[model samples]
Target: MQFREIIRQALYSLGANRLRSALTVMGVAVGVFSIIGVMTALEAVNKSVETGLTSLGANTFQIQKYPATVFGSGHRRNQYINRQDITYPQALVFRKTMEGKASTIGFMLSSQANQAKYADRTTNPDVVLTGGDENFSASNGYPIEKGRNLTTNDIRYATNAAVIGSELAATLFTQGENPLNHSIRVGGEVYRVSGIFAKKGAAFGQSQDNFLLIPITRYLNHVKESGSINITVEASSRKTYSRTLDHAVGSMRITRGLTIREPNDFEIRTNESLIDSFRDIERAISTGAFIISFMALLTAGVGIMNIMLVSVTERTKEIGIRKSIGAPQNSILRQFLLEALILSLAGGLIGAAAGTATGNLVALQFNLPPIFPLLWITISMAVCSAIGIGFGLFPAWKAANLNPVEALKGK
Candidate 1:
């Protein structure tokens, strides 16, 4: 028989049992949907994080009280207990000592989810606020869209200058009415807006464009009220990054009065380290999803096998009549196998489309753009084909090996 004839016969057989075929297809669809959706969403989110987090800069790293990628309990408490708050003098000492070795910078952060009000327009509490020096722009990568960057003179005298992000600027000021030179109340304290930052969109779940940047000296002297400080350092280049890190470690050790044998108390965070933390979390999630989807798929495969067996039983007499008349055993086998393949392929396609769409919907919650994974598509199709062949084999073999005498008696 022609391949077309085999396909035509298989399709006709499937059509005869429409409701049963549809139900089996639906079962497969549900199984495939669970896996493809989650994988796509995660991949898109990972890509978005890489792009948004690029601001951390090349060869640049930060030293803090805590590890960027922490995995266990008691970390927050240990951060305060085992670590020392980096002070202004320590930062200055590093600067004076490592002037040619590395570019040392100091900054302080005071974040409050306060309302930005201008004629009743309000913003969400996730607003970002940063306080830093003239070196902040070079160190943290804040690009100015309008007006000038904070000058050294601004920090030397503890200026009340502020740089507003694009989102915050639009929320407070009207079009053509520049926020520069205007006053914006932050935590009930008014400060002159000196510059505007370009749009930064979002990173993970955080909005990068809803921030206010001010001079660090003013922040420490006036805002903090505690007289404490946090210092940030940037390496000169990728080539000198390791040397810069060594210098900072030694310098912090000296400033903190740690002995040569004692372990370091400070933390240094790098971009690679942060990405590794993300990857570790991703690995855990992927493992769980794989186990769940695999079990569900195994159940669905069992369902397919049972349904195919029933289909062979229902068509036993018809199979014997065809075999006695010109249909070879291989032809009968091919016809039944192709029906199972059709059933699985149909289900898989529906599941893939639905899963891809659903994944993007979830990812959109974090402002990550939708992504379609071609590799995933290929893998899913191959899995569907394997399920069809694996489960459809016994049923097809039983039908092909039927006794013509018994089947003829039934007919």
Candidate 2:
């Protein structure tokens, strides 16, 4: 038979058993959906993370008590815990030491889940309260949109001054009402607004402009007294970044009183390092999704083989009649294989469409651009086609090899 005729016959056969064909197709769709959906969402999140990491100023790196991300056993957690806190005093000494060596140096301490209140208008308790100095804005890439940033005087005297984010400004002060010089209560302590930061939008589905910044001294005095301080430094130029990082490390070590024999007791986090950490996480998740998808596809392939075998058994007499009529064995084999391929391809198309749509929802949530993940979709369809051919081969072979007289005798 011609290839087109075989395809036409396969379609007719599948339509004859519509319910079974649909169930088999659904099995294949489920398998494809799992991998495609997971990969699509991960792609969107990866893009968002890359964009967010750029919020760090150019040629800037941060020194902190812990790594950007910690993922390990209890022993690893305790290792970070046992290290001494990067104290406020240490941060000050480090800043003084690196004063002329770097272009900008800033330190901050933060507490989360705090609310800000202003005359019957109050924000949700998800605001981040931070203690930072004048250089904080420059190092952290937050340009002051209105008024002025905190000054040396604010930090020196531990004054009740605050730099509010755009989101907080919108929530507390109505249109035509200025936020500067207004007294707002943050975590129960009143602070006069010193500046308003430009809108930075959201990252990872969380608003970046929902926090409030105060002077580091005021933060140390009013907020938690014992937390670690995070120090940020900007190299004067890209050419000097490496030397500056080396200098900063040496200076931080000297400030922390670490002997040359001991390993430095703090973490240095650069944008590259943060991106590398996220890449590690992304790789792990992708591997897991691939494994799951592999197993699911393997099971679906087995189901295809079983259903094709049953189909051959039910058509034994028809096969015998065709063989008696001098039909070629290749025609029978091709027809059965085409049926399986059609089912697999149909399911794959449905799954890819559904998965892409579902995954783009995550992009919307993170305010990121939509992702097509064409590579994954192509691989999925290819795998589905392979499954159809590999699993249908044996059944198709059995139907083509049947003895005409025995098949006619209902054997």
Candidate 3:
């Protein structure tokens, strides 16, 4: 028979047993869905991380009491917690010590889930209240859109001057009123607006422009006392970044009074390091997803084999009739195999569509753009084809080699 005729016959056979074909297809779909869904979500997160996680400027790094991300055992976590806080005093000393070594040194501290109010307008209790210096804008990638940044006088005198993020400004001054020089209450303390930060957009579904920055000194005194401070340092150029980082570590060690024999207690975080860490996590998640998908697909393959075997048995009389009418063994084998291929491919296509849609939903939650994992979809389809052929071979062989006399007798 022509290939087209064989294909037509195979499809008709599957259509005749719609319920069974659908069930088998669903099994394959489940396996493909698991891998594709996970990969799509992770790809979205990776895209966001590459763009949004660069909270620091070029050739810059930060020193903090805790690492940017924490993992591992309880003991490891406790080790970080047990280390002494990077006090404001230590920050001052480090800044003074590294004055000429780096281009700019900035300090910051923060509190979260704070409310902001202006006149009759009030914002949600999700604003980030940060304490920063004049260098805060440059170091942290937030530039002033209007008004002036916090000055030395503001930090030295602990003035109640604040710079508001774009989202927060819009929330409090919705009537197009000027936000600059206006007074707003944050966490019950009032501060005059000194500047407004440019719109920074959202990351990981969270608004980056929903924060308020005040002088670091003011934050320490009013928001929280005796807490760790984060110090940001920017190297003059990429060529000097390594040297600058080395000097920063030594200067911080001296400020923290760490002897040469003692290990550094604080953490140093760079944009590259942060991205690398995230990549490691992404790899781990991908590996786990692949393993689960492999197992699920394996089970689905077994199901396809069993179903094909049953199909051959039920169609024995029909096979006998076809063979008696001069049908060849290869033709019968091809027909059976084609049915399995169609079943597997149909399931793969359905799974791919569903998985892509589901993955995009996760991206939407984070305000990330949608992604189509083409490579994964192709791989899934290929795997399904393999499953179809590998599993369907035995049944096809059995049907092709059946004795025409016994099959006709319904044996």
Candidate 4:
């Protein structure tokens, strides 16, 4: 039989056993769905993060007591916990030391779930309150939309001045109301609104403009005294950025009182490092998804093999009659193999579509754009085709090698 004729015969056979074919196709679909769904969601989140990180500006890095992301356990986890807090005094000293080497060095800290109130209207307790120095806005890419930024004097005096984000501004003041020079209650303390930040849209479903900012000194004194602070540093020039990172590392070690032989106790995070961390997480998730999909496909492959074996048995008389006439062994083999390919390829197409849709739904919840994973679709179809060949070969060979007289006599 010709290849097209073989495929046509295969389809007819599959159509004859509709329920069995559906069940077999379902197994392959499930396997494809597991991996494709996970990968699509991960890709969407990664894209969102990349865009958000780019808005943090260029040649900037941050220092903190602990790494932004932690992996591993036991001694490594405890080591990070045991590190001393990056004190306000230490931050001030570092700022003084790096005066000529860095463009802007800002100290910052934050408290979440604090309420902000203007007269009778109060925002939800989920509001975030941040404390930073004069250069905080410049270092953090927060452009002042109205009024002026906090002055050095504010940090020095630990003044009750505040800069609110655009979202917060809208919440606190009426449409035409100028928030500058107005007092609003944040965490039960009244602070004069010194400036309002430009609107920054949401990332990962969380609003970037939902927080209020105050002087870092005021934050440390009133919000929480003994906690660690994050220090932001911008390089003086792009040419010196790498050297600046090395200089900052050495300076931080000195500030923290670490000896030559002692290991440094803080983490330095740059835009590149943050991206690398996220990629590492993505790899881990991808690995897990691969494993789960492997198992599911393996089971599906077995099901295909079992169903093919049954098909060979049920069509014994037909096979014998064809062989008794002019049908060749390879023709019979091609027919069975074509049937398996049809089932697997159909399942792969369905599963890829379903998985992409499901993953986009998850991405939508996080306010990320929908993504169609073309690479995964190609890979799934290729893998499904391989599964077809791997599992179908034996049964096809069995059907082809059967004794025509014996098969016909079996009734």
Candidate 5:
């Protein structure tokens, strides 16, 4: 049969059952919409998360008590006792042991949205308060822009000195008069601004430049309840990362008193490990999306089959009349198959458009760049069309094979 005849038959059949065809098309559209929308949103957020994880320099690794990504709260607290602190002493041991292999820097951050006062000047509470020991600058890439980095002497004597990030400096001090000698009150104690940090821009939607770095010793004294004292280890190079990590873990396991067979209680986090965690989350989301979308598609496929069967039944006498007039069996089958394809393709286009819009809308709200899952959209539409053909086959074939006599008798 010619292409024009096939199309004519498709349009006539679909238009003849206008409301039913629309409802069936809506079902397919919903399926594609669910999966495509989710994929786009996730791609945008995943990009943001990856940028955030690698915000710290590539060579850096951190040792702490908890995993980098904490899911649904209170579970960690309830399941484990002895919420150990990676003590200052333990970190010192790690530093001494790692020696030439990796550069170890000890830090402990205590963040509070506390008021900052400088005479009549009041700063916002959202400012980050980071506390680092002597090696903070080298290991974490926080180079000093003005005054010297914190020294062992500073931590030893619990010095009342602080370093401001570039953004925080701008907010507090005016006209580039140097914030180095100025004093700011934090938690009711006056701390002299000893240095200013160069701007590092935003990391994972949070401003990295909006922070203050003070001696870790002073932080421990002031914010007595800081959870885990983190030890950051910068591996010698990317090539040596695995060995460096293994060496750190082995040494830490020995120092922290874990037996050969025992698993270490502490967690070592790196950008790659953080990515693995995100992968787990992404997998879960993808699985849920597949299940939901598949159910919708399955319903649509059943609806297509039902509609195809009804079309075959209603056109019984037409099939008999066509067969008597020498219409080939393959042509009859082609007509039904083409009709189903047109329905699926129509729904797929509308669904792809809707999904893209919804996904981009969500990304915009989260301050993330919009994403188009073009590959997924293409594959999904193709799959929907394939489903229509596959499911409509039996009914189409049955209609093609119907006995002309019985069909003409209106059975």
Candidate 6:
């Protein structure tokens, strides 16, 4: 038989068993979906993290009582929890001691799930509330778009002045209405808006602009819980970042009263370190997804093998007649293999489309733009093709080697 005729016959055979073909395709689809969906979602998050998690601004790092993210035994976690909190007084002392060594020093404390109100419009209670100093904007990259940032007087006097994010300003102020000097209630305390922050997008499905900043002193005096402060230190230049870190570590240890024999009680975090932490987490999840998908694909390959073996058995007489009529063994093998390849490829395409759409839905919820993982799609298709060849080889070989007389006699 001609090669074209063999391919036509293989497709015709698969088409004849609609239910079996559909089920076989579904197995491959499920396998592909498992990995593709996970990878798509992680890719979106990775993109967001590149821009969002690195908000510590250039040449800046922070010292806080606890690590940003913790994973380990209960004892390890409890050690962090039991460490003495980085206090406001301690931050001030560190600032004073590191004055000439650093370009800028700032303190910040925050709370979540607080509502902000203007007139009758009330924002969701998911608003973030922060207390910081004059250098907060410079340290964190939250530039002021209108009015002015907090001053020394605001912190010294414990003034109720506030700087709001772009989203919060929009939520509280109408068109042509000035947000400056407007009184807004946050956490049940009224404060005059002093500045408006430039627009900052979302991070990890949370709004970065849904926040209000006040002077650190005012936050400590009224808004925030005690001992929840973090100190930010900025180096004068990129070349001095390591030097600044070393100095800050030494100063913070001294300020915290830690002896040489004791390990440092505080955690120092920079933009690069934060990004590294997230990458580690992403790698772990990606590894897990890959293992799960491999197993699923393995099962799907077995299913394809079983279905192809059954196909060969059902078409035994056909194969016998073709062999008797001068059909080559290679043609029989190629036909069965093509059928398996087509089945897996079709399922992969379907699964990739469905997984991409589903994963983008997760990104959409976080206000991130849609991403089409073309690379993943290509890789998935290639993997599926490999699976088809690996599992279908045995069945194709069995079909090609069948004895014409025995097959034709239904033995």
TM-score for each candidate, following the candidate numbering: 0.88, 0.95, 0.97, 0.91, 0.80, 0.96
Tens-digit lDDT track of model 3 for 32-136: 998999999998888878777667766999999999889899999999999999988888889999988998888898889999999998888999999999998
Worst ten-residue run, lDDT, model 6?
49-58
**What local distance difference test score does each model get?**
0.79, 0.91, 0.90, 0.89, 0.82, 0.89
5 or 6, which is superior by TM-score? Answer: 6
Clashing pairs in 2: none
Most accurate candidate by TM-score: 3
Instruction: State in Å the error of residue 180, model 2.
Output: 1.8
* Tens-digit lDDT track of model 1 for 315-337: 87898898889788999889888
lDDT for residue 196 in candidate 5, whole number 0-100 = 82
lDDT: worst 10-residue window of model 5: 75-84
Better of 2 and 6 by TM-score: 6
Between the candidate structures 3 and 6, which one is better when assessed by TM-score? 3
Candidate 4 Cα misplacement greater than 4 A, ranges? 1-9, 173-177, 203-205, 324-331
Model 3: lDDT of residue 376: 93
Which ranges of candidate 2 are over 4 A from the true structure? 1-5
